[model samples]
Target: MEEFTQQAGPFTDAQQWWIEKIADATAATETDFAPKLLEGFPFSARGGTFGFLHDFGREAAINLLDELRRALA
Candidate 1:
């Protein structure tokens, strides 16, 4: 998580907010963290094509962060 906050740069304001929120929720061990995260980005295929693409990009960012975390660990 620290790795994410540190190295995952060049993020938009909204993306940065989400990243910080995720880190905070994770550190606090928020039980509903996943749900809250999803709620924050309520974009889906059913919503619109662009939204789906945006969500896909967000997922990729998350996957990259996870990979980084695992590699560091």
Candidate 2:
């Protein structure tokens, strides 16, 4: 995740904000749950992927937050 943030740039304001939020949430999560929750999160913009929260857009990000909430529950 740090690699993606350091290497990727020029993201939309929304994308940037959500990515940081996601990173923060991930950091707050328990170590065991973090990996599973982020298992499919895109870490790079390779192979036509949008990378991280860029691919998630607003709705997906919201859904992911909900999932994270559920996991923490």
Candidate 3:
């Protein structure tokens, strides 16, 4: 996702922390947290869902991810 890549370097460091918070919070409120959110994603949007990520709307990020997947495929 363009927005995701721009917001977080990788889901490696601070970005990982950012998304972990959302996962943590979601888990506290819902039992089906990670699975529900991660079911069909490209595995790169996690960082953005947390505070570690910034500025990416869903469409831009999905589009970017789709393009990247297409290229890789």
Candidate 3: which pairs clash?
Answer: none
Model 2 / residue 2 / CA error / Å: 5.7
What candidate 1 gets wrong by more than 4 Å, as runs, is 1-3, 30-37, 40-59, 62-73
lDDT of 2 by residue, 10-72 (tens): 556656665565566565664423433444444332212244435666566566556545544
Clashing pairs in 2: none
Residue 20, candidate 2: C-alpha displacement in angstroms: 0.5
Candidate 1's displacement at residue 40, Å, is: 7.5
Give the number of colliding residue pairs in candidate 2: 0
How does residue 28 of candidate 1 score in lDDT? 62
Q: What is the alpha-carbon lDDT of model 1 when measured against the actual structure?
A: 0.49
Q: Which residue runs of candidate 3 sit more than 4 Å off their true CA positions?
A: 1-10, 31-73
Ranking by TM-score: 1, 2, 3
For candidate 2, give the lDDT of residue 40. Answer: 48
Regarding lDDT, does 1 or 3 come out ahead? 1
Ranking by lDDT: 2, 1, 3
